[model samples]
Target: MSSVGDLGKVKRVETDVVKCKSCGGTMVFDPATQSLKCEHCGNTEVLSRDTNVLERDILEGFEKAARFDRGEQASFKCSNCGAVVMLGADESAAVCPFCSTPIIVKEEYFGGLKPQVILPFKFSADAASDFAKRWAKRRLFAPRKFKKTLSPENMHGVYEPAFTFDSKTRSTYRGRVGDRHTRVVGSGKNRHTETYIVYRNVSGTFDKFFDDVLVANNSNFDQKKLSSLLPFALNEQCVYEKKFLSGYMSEVYQKDVKDGWTDAKKIIDANLYSAIKSTLHCDVVDYLDISTEHSDVKYKYILLPVYFSNYRYNKKDYNLMINGSNGKTSGKTPISPWRVLFAVLIGVALLALFIYLYSFAE
Candidate 1:
């Protein structure tokens, strides 16, 4: 239970900075060692985690807005691609990892809610790049140059912005479902089978609890393509620490919490519809209209690890996403014109051979 008084006390909390003891250089979170590593001295510092992941009441969070001052991290907005990038506080300059365009720091942009839990990158940069190369090798239509010239430079380890929602919903639905049936009528030439659907009015109450429904908050990237890299091990999350963001770049959430919840409900409704349909146990559905009442809804703004990169082919850019937790890769590449032509030729040859075999059999 929370009151308005609790809203006043709720504010953005900052994580402590992790510095290298051996050298004066700042330590960054390294996925390979699961510790903070210094770029200048190669010193590794271990981080302790004990915080349990908690889901905040979505309705209550709207009452108190939290904002954190930029202490040890710098925020940059890409002018060309409109990406909000966060970098180390000591470093003042950086290029946009998505478009390779120069980014300038913006002071007015308020960083969104601090992540409570983060699934750290499980794959190193070299390993992620290797996964991308292997994935591309299976894509027969991918251009030869794209695979041959593919190097690790295009891959970047990024902390992508996302929100996870939990909710208990009670939906009262009313809809019509149909089952297909066939009937034979008349005789001889008039004897024909007619297919018709038998419709029935149905109403039911559905109660469901959705634990985690992940939604993307970044708009700069292709969301559908990003979703292809799913099944991230959310159970392996740790308390969000600034050290975890040491070497990687993080994106500021462009979507607001309110909007994020709205999107979440859409996903919930779709899942609920499927659940209802499954309960009905019908082969076909003509139409279904459902009205839902959601309660005990909670959400958490978190950052997930991803190895994002892009490549250019024929003056067009194709984006790639690698799941940082499991090394799953998904991306778009330019299709080779020669490969399509060769496939067409092979199909024609096969058709000709089939026609000759049929004629000989006849």
Candidate 2:
């Protein structure tokens, strides 16, 4: 949890206001129309979709210190949850998506790098909450009340930071590969087929192009749960526009570009290995060594939309994430202890019945 002293040092940055052309009321991005909608006048302003989203040179990014904060935000420290989040300057007080604690906006945390592209939300909070309820219904061990009482008010739309790396790789690899084969080594009564691996030295040059391999840069959320929200329509991303961020909050990238590259390289290496193995067409690889040279490496800092909700059950917090682009949901829910106990009792009864049958047979 954040200390009162820590919160005292925080300051708020003024945000640019987007007003409705008709009523002059505050306007927010409406996902359904892909435009800015006025809360008071019910008017909508269409944002241009002519996005020229570009990838920056990876080597160039390495030459500079990578920053995560974009200066257009106000910082808030959640005293109850210890979550430091950036909210739009206009948003004075908001709830922490991680622990559902109210946070008071204060200072600017850091002047971070601006995202190159954004995938805006396609669904509303009510839709995301409905998806969550339907998803909860599918869990056999979930409590019934959880499904009945899950509310849309608990879910909020937030933008998550990620890095998408594109690269053209050339690799030279050498390895010993083996193919399994069987042969009869004995005759007559002693005849038996023995399996042997036929090994051969292999060397090859492999080239592959990797596009938009995404790696999340946030440490606050569950990595596996975040991954389950994938297959985002990343191709439909738009150039960074403040209009898109009217009402939503975004996470500052915690992993720097260099560290992000390291993660991207790990993904590339695995893909390279698969490509090399496919070229060799070997049943088993004994040992493989590869040296890769990457050229035309490009990366883009991107924001993906998600509807986030956190719930606490049995003194533990569970997170639910809905893909803002497609409404696909993933989350952790509370398990019913009574259901688990009943399952254990039934298992014991089955075991006892099997033992009684075995005794009669004996």
Top-scoring candidate (TM-score): 1
Write one digit per residue (lDDT tens) for candidate 1, span 259-334: 7888889889989999999998776887889998888888887778888777789999988788999988887889
Each prediction's RMSD to truth: 8.8, 5.5
Question: Model 1: clashing residue pairs?
Answer: none
Q: For residues 1-362, could you state the per-residue lDDT of candidate 2 as single tens digits? A: 22233434455443344678898776778887899888778999999975788999988778655553444444555554556655653343344567654332332434445667989888788888888888888887888766765677877877777889998999999889999999998888999999999999999898899999888887754346567998898877999776777667666577778988998898789888988898887899999999999999899988889888887777888888889988788877888999788889999999999999999999
Candidate number achieving the greatest lDDT relative to the actual structure: 2
Q: After superposition, how far is residue 227 of candidate 2 from its true place, in Å?
A: 2.8
User: How many backbone overlaps does candidate 1 show?
Assistant: 0
